[model samples]
Target chain A: MLITKDIKLADVILQNYHLIPIISRFGIKFGFGDKSVGQICTQYHIKTNFFLEIVNAFNDKDYKPYEKLKNMSLSLTVSYLLKSHYYYNKVKLPFIENLIDSLEWEGEDNLKNKNVLKKFFRQYRKEVNEHTANEETEIYPYVLELEQNYNNTGKVSVSFLEKLKTKSIKDYADTHDELNSSLLDLKNIIIKYLYPAENKDITVQILIEIFKLEKDMTDHTELEEKVVIPVAEKIETELKKRY
Target chain B: MAVKFSFLIVEKSYIIRSGLMQIISNFYETGVVNELHNVDTLLKKLSEVNADVLIINAKLIAAVPELILDIRKRFEQLKLVVFAGTRREADEFPGFDLKISVDEPKHLIVEKIQSLINEIKPKKDNNLSENLSEREKDVVKQIALGKTNKEIGEALFISPHTVITHRKNITGKLGIKTVSGLTVYAILNNLIKIEDAV
Candidate 1:
């Protein structure tokens, strides 16, 4: 089912609870008695269309709105990405790490393996922190500047356009492939390699959370690669021709 | 028959690159295609993509003559294809696993790629059961009992190499990679007691 602006926010949550965290990233609070998605977005002063596209992308695996996505502004997209970084570092990573710490190992070998997993996850968290930090300090600023320049200039000179190749997003951002794979490796290690406490439910929960994070991270990267980069590249090409 | 293969194409010309992609995708039920326009990115891309077949333009190979040999050394499983527009251009890169003349009929081009895959594919057993075989179950029991590979080999009266192969097959079949994970599986399956696992 395609999520639309007029759909009741309450009903949307009832249909897919996975979108709750995604919606929260938009600075939306609960207690929506019976408001529509558009009304809630208007309350929060969020762009309702962008919010719908993001939540829809997160909710449905097959929903890729490339044409609509390319039309999104860097400021809006980057703001959403920054909030996702906050969610991961503040809410998701810490929660997973706490769950991992709470897990009880049955044997010495299992304890050793658990230590490895803990170390692996800590390192993975560090990598993600570095990646998002790089994007914030580096990629976002460059794109926002490019966008500002894109708006200002039909008078862009030939020499300035020559310098655009080095400024391409491909050089800086590899689009989170390493981060994605490391997390997948961690998930597989838990599922296939390590055996935790006999109750096993905590391990299952940990796996489920990792799986969800992986999906969310994929959507995040695809938005950058398929949408943002293309738009940025289009701007670069647009700057090449002079008025 | 449902086997899917991944491919990497290195061509500078957009027309040829897109043309090749369209052809391969049209032919296969599923295929992963990665493209690079220049040799500058080839080595980095090759390391990342892990493609089964590399259909590279002959000119790119000519410019970097030792690249094919280097790729062969690193990725022993990778099959090579010379993507030449003319037969004579392809002849310069002789002894390749396959050649794709972009002008070839669509079906013929696909057939050449499929034939290379057939030549490289490992033999499959007809009795490829989804479940672990009796021998594999016995191996899991021995693994849960904390037996080393040599110990398991001695107990099973099989060569250590054969035992290792069985262990790999067991991992593939059960999706349990570690001995401890297999121990849990063994205990759950009644192949071994919980106390034996501990």
Candidate 2:
């Protein structure tokens, strides 16, 4: 499918229904009327190219947005990523945790099993929190600084950023830890082993939440890995060449 | 019949080891994975079992610098992957067949391992002569290089429609449509070098 700026947001959503959640996150509503993707995104103050790149990348498995993404602002990409992190940590995680907490587990063994599930979730949440926190506190700041440095100086020395304990963008990527497997383990325990017959409804609810969070996290990481890092590396190469 | 692959993992962290095992189990329908905390047991196990792959942690490799070469000499067919926690660690072990940062998400790691397995044990029936025509192979090489269909047609003195037809035929025969997948196939079949494809 051809994805040009002239296409309406409503049309794009109609073509690829999976993009509804992603586009909706940017606060664009349905019934966009006659507004094109370019217009709506500009109205919402979203970077049109970045939005198109992301949407197209999501829609087409073969689409590689890295080259087009280099011309786009890193700050916009970083901000979008930061917002996703916020949604995951602040909104989705707590909602799931609350669901788990509200479920009734009868008898001592069931209570024990519930506690185990809770403990596993807590551990997983802690890992995710730390991971996102690291990106927010360390990686994103470093990337922003690199961008600013390059913009202000017109040329940045690798050693200058290294002095601030910020190496290349690749270094930040290297430090990333695999997000925990406890979520899967938690799902397995509940589905295959722990949940009693009567608690099927709650179990289904919890699984749905978990599945949503997993997909969000996967998409978030893919953006960072495939789009953000490559763009950053390109910037780094450009800066190095200038120096 | 599927080839049953066995993995020997040498990681210091029990959590990571178990996590890797869980991911492997989920990814592969038939495989055996044995984990060891240190280098000595890994060596002992290597002697007894013909593991298809050795996934050693970079930290352990650092502690025993000779382990990689030692294993290479003994098990010439075994694929070596250095599972690194950091890029620095990964950089240190450049000699390994692959250096995967443990930082990569689980699905990516599984995908990487699966591709590696396919590389090691390529399907006999999918050989280029039997499946892909010579013309289709040429189209695949161009596709893998990120060439547009128009560009490919220009190069081959064919119409864009002809290029698309060849692409469809190639995808049909190979059962893979993505350019990345075609690139991998091209690389595996020696149609294009890795550097050129990249």
Candidate 3:
């Protein structure tokens, strides 16, 4: 179901509790006293439409807000993405890594392969960091500048204009394919090959976390490739003519 | 990797059937042989064993001529090999994947069957639930190195269709649908190294 602005914030939570962490990304706090989504957004200073679109996209996989997202500002998109990165880096990855680190092995064979599994996950964490870091430093800043230059014409910075000469959004978009692949491989390795006997419950918990992370990453990538990149490309085309 | 195929041989003569089974079992170590004197339960046996190759006697198909067409229509993925004892019998048989004659050398029969098995490998066997079979791992390795289905098929000496079959099985077993995800599986499993990926 598409969550709208008038839906109560508590009802939205009841609809999809998974959005609790997602809402937290938007600086929304708990303890809402029977407030609608619009009311909560106003309280939190979040654009209600943007919040709704983001929430609906996460809640329902088929709810692609392509036209709606095109209407959303680039700063809002980038800001939301940055917050997601912060959550992934500071909270999620570390939690998963710690869970993986403490996993207990059963036999000689499983024990032998445990370190390789750990190393593989650690490597994935590293690769994810590299990907997000690249976007954070190189891509997102360029996008924000592209938006700024497009919106505030004749005030385009010289450095930003120079950047426009060499780089394009397609370059970044093309590199989005391998976002959560290693995480997938790690999951396969766990379920298929390197299952732990001791701390089996914790291992299952780790898998649940990994699955959630993969879904979140997939949604994030889909939003970028489908919504953010296309919108920015149009803005880029416009700004290219002026600058 | 060498192919692993379960063979379902439908031949009436006990001597010929046992002889064929012995020859196949000797050289084709991974081949599982099941013999039947009649085609009455062929379809049921095929489904039950999920056999990869079907070796039918031309005489039996000559009696029940529609059996060939029926099997073809139903199990297109099945590798059909005909055992025709004579030139006339061979002529009566359709263009199967392979035709073994009574006079052909045992080595020739083994070679032909081996090549046929190599050309097509079925995916998602029940025994493969715990792990990917060796052939699936090969496909994963090629996939991880960022090769297309055509390229992987050519490299593995299998058809693109067979490659896709393996890919589907790989996805089913590993639950990693993306090529990038399979590539990561390859890397983490040491099927391929990081430097090998493009």
The candidate that achieves the highest lDDT relative to the unseen native structure: 3
Compute the lDDT of residue B30 as modeled in candidate 1. 34
TM-scores, all candidates, are: 0.58, 0.52, 0.60
DockQ of 2: 0.02
CA lDDT of B15 in candidate 3? 87
Fnat values, candidates in order: 0.00, 0.00, 0.28
What's the lDDT for all of these models?
0.78, 0.73, 0.79
Report per-candidate DockQ: 0.05, 0.02, 0.15
Q: How many residue pairs in model 1 have overlapping backbones? A: 0
Clash count per candidate: 0, 0, 0
* Model 1 interface RMSD over true interface Cα atoms: 7.6
Model 3, B197: alpha-carbon shift in Å? 15
lDDT of 2 by residue, A51-76 (tens): 88878877775566767776777888
Q: After superposition, how far is residue B166 of candidate 1 from its true place, in Å?
A: 17
Look at candidate 3 and give me any clashing residue pairs: none
Candidate 3 residue-wise lDDT, A100-156, digit = tens: 778776665454445555666676777778888998898888888888778774666
Q: Give lDDT tens digits, candidate 3, residues B1-198.
A: 234678898998888887877777765435577878899999889988888788888888888888778888888888888888775667667758888888887778888877776577445244445478989888999988889999999999999999999887777667777665565567657798766865
